[model samples]
Target: MNGGAVLLPYRSNRPWLSGRDRKRIAQVLVLVLLVLVAAAVPQGPAWAGANLIANPGLERVDVGGFPVCWEKSGWGDQSFTFGLTGPGHTGANAMQITLATSPNGDRKAMMLENPSCAPNVTPGHQYDLSVWYTTTTANTVMTMFRHDVAQGWVYWTDLATLAVTPAWTQKTVRTPQVPADTDQIAWGVTIYGVGTLKTDDYAMEDVTAPATGTACSAGDACVKGVWQVLPFNSPVRGLHTVVLKNGNVLLVAGSGNDPDAFAAGTFTTAVYQPTTGTFINVPTPADLFCAGHVQLPDGRVLIMGGNKAYPAADGSHGYEGLKDSYVFDPATNSYSRVNDMTAGSWYPSATVLGNGDVISLGGLGEDSSGTVATQYFSQAQQRWLGLGEAHQTWNFWGLYPSMILMQDGRLFYTGSHVFGNGLPGTGSSIYDYDANTITPVSGLQNKDQRDQSMSVLLPPAQDQKVITMGGGNIDSNPDANRLTDVIDLKQANPTYTAGPLLPTGTLTGGIPQTTHQGKMYVSAVLLPDGKVFETGGGLHNRADPVYEASMYDPATNTFTAGMAVDPVPRTYHSSAFLLPDGRVMAVGDNPGNGSFDMRLSVYSPPYLFKGARPQILGLSSAEWAYGSTRVVTVDGPILKAELIRPEAVTHSSDPNQRFVDLPMSVSGNTIGLNLTSNPNIAPPGWYMLFVVGTNGVPSVAQWVHVG
Candidate 1:
């Protein structure tokens, strides 16, 4: 075997090793190497032939429900990507998806075309389908279909039917079966419905598989079952504020009156995954008001300033706030000191900036009375940098100064005041972060937007809308009292002609008017579908309606009747991530302890539609044989046409003709078409021909046959 020569025994009777034998051996070795390389590759968009289809090399029929995924680590799209761009559209702001029927009633789902996936899927082996989805009717069913050549029509051959839930859910579907004797595949999705399907995004990518599925199971058990809440024994006596991080929930609440001492505790924050639900104590350096807490992107929480318990003889402990900060890390299950703020304050507002830092607004500083001093934390510096002085000082209270970041990178601060010494008096100014300036804009809306209220940006449509929920004046000013006004902030944009008020109302009639100091109050969360959930505000009930929750749908611009769910009346609590699975965890917030109330609860959104739920039609077992025949007939007007193949095509006659629908549109254009074969679908000799037409009337059908 020296110098790459064959070392075989010298057998005079054997025929000489021919060139053909060497070529065959080489071919086998190359194939073995290819398989070895493929197996070593991680599953996802990065892998070759990592098309939307699963088992790409094997040429299997993926069918719907086979679990198409985008590796979580990939930078770009893996399956499919859609850009809804044209004249007048604001790039691609938000998207929704629905399964509906064409005017003639044919099943259809939305599709996104990616130039990258097209090369991998043209005329053959794998295809992609995806949507930006939200639900209005809870039980709406969305399905995926394929063009079957065997029968000369489109059918639900590879179905991925999804049920419409109140919140938005993103879906991806792929078909792996490829036709033999071809190198091209055509693909499209349709939502079978009569009503319009609203979607903000549509995409497709050449991906291997997702790292993990975001949901588990079906029905209410799927959403409601993933969470469990750990209740406080003393019930966070006067629970006031709540925040979530990692899988742990943190609360800065008060308990046991006297000097009105505040306490703290922890729960869970793991989003949609099933959590063990444990309750732990958050040790405070001193007994004080746990005014506000914000989570840093690196997972550390900045526990802000608050007043101490028992008026410190000279009224210092009871009235003054503490700037001593603590950072709680779930990784180690412990709290450590982080750098403290420049000023000791209470009733401060903290907003997470786009760069991952937090900008803390003013509140009552060391004087025990409120002051408008502003400071922001620079993660790099691990210290707070003063943002000069607030527009107003000692004017804003430590409660209900709303801070919400818009997608455009602007921090909108709506309510603060201008008392004689910078303590909260009464003012409504809109601040611009880029310029670090505040300009007062007044239709004189909710001056009481301070405590026991919440605000969220409606999924920024091209239109750009923002909503402000409940707040009241706690007798500070006679005109400012407990309110329930749904103010539309969209009208007050930097540049905007007055659009309609998009529906408006208040929660006045049936709720009560308690002491109104209104600590530990919360507002609502924006659902993927443009609806919002208003939860954990003050005790506003006909028969003590405090611990109640309701939903506000932007489509109709109205709030639903409230439901009792909060274990205790929560104010100053926090809820993040309306999980695609439809469950929201609310942590922090005590009854009014001004501190010690550390409690946690889970708020699940309502099911929008009710009926027999549609199941995720799993992948079918049938495979299409290659070199099979397909015959397509046009019964109506020609319009445009397209031919969709099951997977990528390797070789075939006129692969372009596969997309037959795009070119054939006339008053009565009828054509008979032939689909050839490809090696990708070896063993099998057929392909699924999916088609869509818009001859004036829309038509979608598929057929399966030999080419």
Candidate 2:
């Protein structure tokens, strides 16, 4: 076919052509038509995936002159204007939002609040969200909302904080798994400060797919784990979270960081049953808001010191502590009064001795000054010891100092504190209570900035090693540091040595930060798998929630970075503890804006999603004594066994929580686990016993009393 002319059949016209010629001419014409069509069609980016957003380019508008499938949304007292701007990143129109005066709240241009406009999401699947924006404010964050079948539309989480960009920039972030029962989701970029923000294209794509096959592998839920936001919020602010011996969680608020509640004497406490997902309110006798708590030998919680008074509004005075003490019997779910301490304590550190006595130190006294007296709670008498009975240290330790018990009955201060500049001297010391002496241990890096740092007793407690990681001086510093320090207390003179730098991960700013990006208020949970699961923290005091998580293998002394991140801002006043089911429960986040997040989230580790968890068939005895070996029957061969102390955590200062490895020899389904000879290694109290199968999956813990 020449000059786009069709080939005619052999007939009375031009020259006759063969059948092969006609077929070849027809094929040539078809190829030419395809070329024209291909040239006329538009081409997309090579890496473009299926975008789940509707009206992604803002090219379509509704009758009100607003972008279709989108609406202007905000809260608090903010004067703002929202409309279609010009020169979008991909189209002719872009959404523009301006804040004239934002004294409180925030504003955002988000997807419409209807089912037709919101993007549908699958439970337990993560999505990558991106948006092109240019903003004048540094206080912008990516926000999202989910539609729940039972609860309707609710705020999900602040995905990430966005950095200031004068020029249009495309920021991409991965959201934690879409919570269960969530049918759809809406998201947008938010401006909490006075600024002008312009946005163009928006995109969201599911990145996590459902697992395939029976075997577990990388990139699957079985390897990366998953996080789920509980449908119901905690009735009380979980300022104090303790994993009780009965497998229920005791959540203590005691004024719950609310100045008004403190003024009204509205103390609160609740017992949460993880199995039933229910809460039973307990009558609180005193203001235990910043109190010291630990599990007694008999499984009762000994709570001491608390909020006597809130700080003065004009800075003339500060928070005052109370000397009242009480004990909560888990069986009765009631608190009974105990003898008052010698001095008031607002944020004391409670360490249960091997003999069952409790020593509480460091906290603001009633007068708002450092409390110098060391208060001792006598388990035998169930009261605070008289001044003459207990020796005084005559030293003022900082608030919430991590005072872990050493094997020799001395206490090791790991230089971790909260809400202050830290103590004087080296910030870490060994206190011999009987001798009334303090020996300073050196080599802790940035001791003053260790506030809200987490000090964890390395798993297999016989190792006698402690790791302090990630801290910042919330009172004076603007950034936290990714520092990990390990100390071998068994040394002649134990001193902290630099360990591996915390592995890098994406920060809340939707950027992959360097390893130098650290965090404060970090929760380091001791896992039954003999690893430390570090998650939930903030870059600043109570703002800039960081989105980094990892599993620290004590055996290798290395961190497996990029674990699943919790979708909540677990900042100051947050706490996390291991549940009996090999999961971690995280709660509470009192941010700088004076708001308390009561939502709770649970994280199931990779081991749980792994095939068939080991099962504990029976134990020779639930009560274990020092220097003893017990026989445990399991459904399958176990590679290891552990005894994890029940958690009595508050302000991330639970020196009581430790993982004690039980040396085991497996023969078929029966295992012999030799308990430690030293009571100091595994303190005399209730513990959760877990057995790990050869497949690395741990069984549901069984409550065992170790003495």
Candidate 3:
């Protein structure tokens, strides 16, 4: 048996009569060989196995190192199917199976029954079952059970408790002959909720159950428990604001839990000394409520209004969102009163405009629900003036209101209906007053209203990108709980372009982050690096868990994180910075597990250093797409261009979307790449491009639109 050649079984033996048979066999063999040889020869660039199983479609085939599958959907009914079935008899009692879904928005699933099998199983027998599945929802489950002519079907009681990994979790269900149904058994996986999901290539082998004494000992072995990296070891609560400052972190707690009946003592705030990892006393105003902090360009931090917390015994004490604002001078390590709002308010948004004035938007006011009041600080006057209320007149609670400053200098607010949920009525947009005339971003209304939704200007670059992260729905449908989605605002609003779609897995709660310093600091910061850093945010349940922080390198259009994770898991946390020395800080609201001790954490560069400009590399169509060319060059100290596709000149379909992946082999200053070609060889489109670094961090994707 030659390793180079795979041999198939053949039958033959005679000589004279075999001579004639041999000739015929030779002809057939030559014909088959010629056909295969012809197929191997390519007219264009070779397909270097670029296709992967993007979705579980009907065409389940793997060739030349690539697994290809596709999906199709009708107007209403949808399914995941294929055209291949294998003939088998040698294996033990076998069942051929695959996964399927009912339709979109419908969470129910049905197993396509095998024509011959009655979904039966016998006790004292062993069976191997396998299923190929993918889902957009979590409540779906694989149900296995038994059936008898006399006693109906005895379903396995712990079917739903089996496993819970969102990805394809393969489980082998071994039966444990209950008192009921010793002879006949029926087993199947079923969907449990109201959303549509699908499975394919379902099959079973050696299907049977344990003889008599075997029953599942462990009932529910699902994934639980928080992955703890460090312990806070302190009992603190009502920690609303967290900040990293002056080689230390500060935890400004809203008065919540205490030992005193009327109140233990004075309102206290703790400062963390990273050098010792301990919280120390910090002099803050007594009864300080919830406050937001912003670092001045010169390094002072401005701390703004929050409500005072009273003892639990006192009925009138809780988060009292206030409008009084103060300034914290890190240099002096002290706090000072700056300016009071024109109106009584708390929970109002205080975002530092590009011009350095803090813009305070809607929050709960003394009058009622929340003030639609919008105010921007006049640096020259050193006072907060009423910019104007929202387009619609109503107080907002700002559960998750939109307070985004667009590239065109517009401030858009949405989701602040009550200080809790962003309803359609609560969703409103406001252009910056700087624009003289305020214009509403019409048509792109908040139909599927959102709360906790995030909006970030895809900072202006050579390519434009604006992105909005995860948000909760105002309406009742849970299916609207989308974990990840992308909007290319660049096409409609040329100035806005969001980052590329995250690779493979869903964004952990739609986290849109930028980089700062050598370390990927989240929350917010203008660390050692010139770029901005956004840590993590909480997302929908189905989305991949985001526990990591990434550095956004705008120069190169990429983000990278080697191994260090965030100091703590923070979703609804406040991340900002104090410049000059460039220390980044974060304070989380409902930090994971509601642990009040999940206090403010700050991050400085693991090592001190000057920053380097991002290395941008452009991919060339000739070198990477489908052409035989394979060369890449770093153009400016910032830009890199390479020929990634060259074979699609003739098949000019959408010449702008084609691209080829290359194997990077560094030779010297010049990096050598094996520019593999595609086989289907459609006309070249723009090549989607990215670059990896010595740190193994790859840049964001860019496209060299093919002509």
Q: Each candidate's TM vs. the true structure?
A: 0.46, 0.69, 0.42
Tens digits of per-residue lDDT for model 3, 1-707: 11111211122223544677666655554455344423322222212222111212222222211112111212234343322332212211112223355444222222222111223343333333444554454445544444544656444322221223334444433222222234433344444333334355444443221223322222221111012233454333324333332444445554533334116554566655645657666676644444444443333455555554332445544344556777655456567887776554555555545454656655555443455655556554556665452232334435324454443445554222222345344134454555434333333224253344444333222122334333444234232222222233224432222343222112345354332101111132322222334444334312223455444444344554432345454543333332222234444434334333345454444322222223444334432333233434542221122222211000001011112233232222343333322222212233334443322223433434322
lDDT (CA) per prediction? 0.38, 0.82, 0.37
Error (Å) of candidate 3 at residue 175 is 65
Give the CA lDDT, 0 to 100, for residue 392 in model 2. Answer: 91
Q: How many collisions per candidate?
A: 152, 0, 76
Reference-based TM-score, model 1: 0.46
What is the Cα-based TM-score of model 2?
0.69
Which residues of candidate 1, in runs, are more than 4 Å off?
Answer: 1-245, 254-274, 308-318, 386-400, 416-426, 444-450, 460-464, 476-522, 539-548, 562-581, 585-601, 608-707
As a whole number from 0 to 100, the lDDT of residue 122 in candidate 2 is 75
Q: Show model 3 residue runs off by greater than 4 Å.
A: 1-248, 256-266, 273-280, 308-319, 386-402, 414-419, 423-430, 435-438, 442-449, 459-464, 473-595, 599-707
Q: Tell me the deviation in Å of residue 474 in model 3.
A: 9.4
lDDT leaderboard ranking: 2, 1, 3
- lDDT (Cα, tens digit) per residue for candidate 2, span 676-701: 65677777889999987656789999
